[model samples]
Target: MGYHVVAMPYPGRGHINPLLNLSYLLVSKDDITVTFVLTEEWLALIGPVSGAPNIRLLSIPNVVPSERTRSADFIGFLNAVFTKMEAPFDRLLDQLGLPVSCIVADTFLPWMTTVGSRRNIPVVSLWTMAPSMFSVHYYFDLLAAHGHSPDDNLPERREEIIDYLPGVSSMRVADLPYPTVGRGGSTRKHVIEAFSVITKAQAILFTSFYELQPHVLNTLRANLPVPIYAAGPSIPFLSLKVPPSKPIASGAAAYFDWLDSQPEASVLYVSLGSFLSTSMEQMQELSMGLKASSVRYLWITRSEASSLQEACGEMGLIVPWCDQLKVLCHSSVAGFLTHCGWNSTMESIYAGVPMLTFPLFVDQYHNSKLIVEDWGIGLKLKQRVGEEYVIGREEIAETVKRLMDLNGNEGRELRKRAKELQETCQRAIKLGGSTDNNLNAFVRDVVQGQCNFAN
Candidate 1:
């Protein structure tokens, strides 16, 4: 039977994007079809899809709460997702004309595993975060057994090493994804449930390359009952192979022109994040700091760009949005001041741009540690004083100056390491590279989904 895979990602940018990228890869192969499922509301939010004729986007009703207001009452939203979504989703599956050969689902939405089990469909659990984070969550019991608890992360014991985890390096307690890091309100229960149900899946897909976390991947493969596939960085490598007629940096020709006028490796590319940002006070302080440092910069943000530009002076250009990967790859772009989101981290690595990590929440702290400590491709920007976590303008200025320093030994070494890592990423995406081989292996032998005659 021909391969007809159905993908249902949790309606979040981070989760949806990697699943879509993986779908693109699958549909690129012959005799394969993909039906991507989303809430009707989310489909409208994401706009249109182009290029792949074999891929189809199918939607269920907006049964869950609005994405915009989700943060307000996250627990209510979680409950809705857990209880309200599955009936409509399963009904939508029944309406599909084609038999679902395989179901690719986000690991966060554990209910999909239930759907798979009830229907006897082969499900592939797609984990959007790092394998290291997955390892921590998958083995939550081990953490408790080793005298660790989520609420027990004391500041005095912050630097204590977590040496017990298999295939994981001993790191400080502060680096574990905890202590103001969780999404709160049923999130832990859902993730733990997600891990528990993975054994029921036919396969598990990690949105990371083997080179990035070989030991972690190996550990997961050995521990899990199902087969595991490393789907790689999940960036837009396909675009590079077959260039678009217009640049992916479309509608930002003005910014590219601005970058072109700058000196080589002199401009700092800044993007905090789309969701969850710093406080207004900190934002104002950062603007003044960038201005004081007098470093050439291009900042991408969705909030109060004009005011930020006024505060930042003529040294920086503020845009509402742009193709981030294209901006990072530009020659004039020196470094990235980032929120350390996993997607942004992977892009920074792929572009070989050393990072100034300012982690805010969730897995970002863990990612920051990997960048600063494990990878040696980034520096930590710390400026908290006393009880006020808000970083001051003077401190921000000093850190920005240090990161963008052309002549400093620390900057030079970071640049060299970043370049080396960039080269490594480039090879990993090549035809015979680890990622390419792994992807080929996946598409060549993917499991089929439900194919009932009634459907």
Candidate 2:
């Protein structure tokens, strides 16, 4: 047998999707047996797929469905995972038929790392977010240490710019994903709990390409106690090797067909990821905006209108869920209207598609800032309604028109820069590249018992 690699991810679609792709890569190598632990609700949502024989899907007790309507409570979820899920996971490791070699878990799930340390099994923390975002979270302790929290209010602090995150230009405190830094209570406690785990992990696996975050990665290596591995462009790694048996469903065909029909460098691709739900008003605005722009677009939206042909009456296409990578690779996709999610950002860069960024919650707003203000390959649309940063349909329409103007000359130049980024991403993932080397070194230094640290 080979190494037994176990992966535990958070219950969200954004986190689970990337980890699953990485597991597939490990399983294909023939030297890994992957035991993927999912929340019970997540497992039920995905149903089943014929994956690698060595890869097994196990369910843990996060019994609550992610969709349950409730006030967003940060502490409630954290405490539940720590108090309940921890013991069963430890038992799962103990009962495994194969000797467990290492556990790779999301950095947000601290209890798993704690269990790994206690059992003497190596644990590698996987970060699905960008390294810049990780750096901010890692340094949050500094804010609290300086009496910045509780004493001062969040809205007051959020106006201050954060200049410390590596490779990042000066970012507003509001740009930091955890915008509630100085606010007391569950949100603050949750941030502290997550950051505490960073120092405890033997190694940290960041899902990013080195070229995309060179200075940030450098800063992380010099400052952090644990090894940091930048192993990414992981999604494209999956796109190149899908098997025949696991065919992409025909339901995704309308988007592809529309993609096929457009002139080269003429279409825009838009999606808000799986987890986000736009207001009906917002959806109608976006639909109208696409029509007003008069550019070919293939949008992946989850709606009853089943297919793109059904959804777009005359203007563009809208499919429930399309093969995003395939659509991005199509020559017709000149611009991307994105939510600036890390995974979507990487995918856009890998496809060399320039973006019109409309970032929403979490780290997305920051990611959008980097791509637009720092990297210059994308543009950020300003909010229309108020200084409060609430964007509306008018902003969406204007941004799309701006990108598609002059037959997309501006979008094309941005695409050229994006292609350069694509090359950088590819180089980092290849043999002897920064990302590949980092993954190997991280395993040896942490997962292979090369380091001894007390928790």
Candidate 3:
């Protein structure tokens, strides 16, 4: 039998999608077999997702919360992830037919490190976010010692420049992950706990390519005890090269037909992820702003799409959902208005689309800072009012115009720089590229049952 690599993705779309993509890459080699383990409920949730013939799908009981109700009590759900699921996952690992090579697990499940210890299997922690964000979590103790950690009663500060974190660029305190801006301490504690135990893993992996953040990767290599690799751009990018005969999402044909009529680089693609959403007032303002901007747009938001369509009719198309990466790659799509989730950010970079960032939760604010300050390929959109942050329709309209103006120098610079980053990312996935090399090295190390190589 080939080397048996088992994967345990955190049960969320954002985490599961990239883990599966990496699994697919591993299974491409005929000498490798990947058994992807998930909760029985999750297998049913994401029905019939594609996989290679050597990749196996197995499930444990639904030990955690359901996907539909996770958001209602996310803290409780997080508690369950950290506490309840490990036993079932441990039992399932033994029932597999072959001897396991190593476990490639989501970084959020620190308990997996312990499970690997007891079972004598090396575990590679896969962090499915930007390496820059990883540094934020890795060095969170420094943030807490310096009074930057979130406290429910603490006053929010925006101007404090944190230049001390190794490899991370200097940015205002507000641009740190949303949790640091005095949100809640429950999730913040869980976040810190997740990264704390990663030293026990055989190595760590980022869903980012090296060229995207070289300094951060270098500094992490120096400070971290375990080996680290950038085996990524880990979206379903390989599939993008194959042209589709029909649209992937429902009613996708109509919108794609609309795209065929629009001029190149004319439409803005918008999606504020499904996990979190804007308030009704904010959504209404956004819809009206799109109408006022007079720029063509294709918006993919789930909530209140009918109402938003009414507000944003003549100049825009609002759909419940579509193939996001496919839509970003469309000829007419010039820019993205996004929640700055890392998956969406990587997809936009791969598609060469500039961004107008409106971050909602953890890591997203940091991702926005990378796009706007470090990368220079996007503009940020958040207006502060006393203790609250709100974006008025006029502000949204003006920023949209600024980003969509093909004739303007600033807009042209954004597009030019976006294409440059896009090329860098594309090259990283090619043969002998950074991502490919790292992935190959990772496989070699796993087969040897060690993590002592440099990237």
My TM-score estimates for the predictions, one after another, are: 0.93, 0.88, 0.95
* Model 2 spans with C-alpha error above 4 angstroms: 28-30, 49-51, 65-75, 143-159, 165-167, 178-186, 243-252, 303-312, 382-392, 406-409, 450-455
lDDT of each: 0.80, 0.72, 0.85
Model 3 spans > 4 angstroms off: 152-156, 180-185, 248-253, 383-388, 448-455
Stronger candidate by TM-score (1 vs 2)? 1
Q: Write the per-residue lDDT of candidate 3 for residues 1-455, one digit (tens) a residue.
A: 57989899998989998999898888876588888989999888766646478888899899999998887778888888989989999898879979998899999998998988888888999999899889988998888788887442134566777899999989777777765322223688788788879888988989999999999999999999888889888888877767776664346347887787899999999888988777888888888888899999999887887877878878888887677888899899999999889999999999999999988877787888899989999998863322156688999999999999999999999999999999999999999999999989888887456555221
The TM-score, computed over Cα atoms with residue i paired to residue i, of candidate 3 is 0.95
For model 1, the superposed segments whose C-alpha errors exceed 4 Å read 179-186, 242-253, 383-388, 448-455
- Per residue, candidate 2 scores C-alpha lDDT tens digits across 203-257 of 8888888878788988888988877778786674565555423334365555555
Worst 10 residues of 1 by lDDT: 446-455
Q: Model 1 has how many clashing residue pairs?
A: 3
Question: Model 1, 1-455: lDDT tens per residue?
Answer: 67889999988777788788888888877789999999998899876778888878889999988888876666677667778888998998889988777788988777887787788777788888888988888888888787665546677877778988888877777777754322454456665676777777777888888888899899988887677889778876676566635434544446877887899999999999876667788789889888888899999987888889878877899988877888898899989999888888988899999999888766787888899989898888742212247777888788888889979999999999999988988898788998888777777655433222111
Best by lDDT: 3
Tell me the alpha-carbon RMSD of every candidate.
3.3, 3.6, 2.6
The worst-scoring run of ten residues by lDDT in candidate 2 lies at 178-187
Candidate 1 accuracy as lDDT = 0.80
TM-score rank order: 3, 1, 2
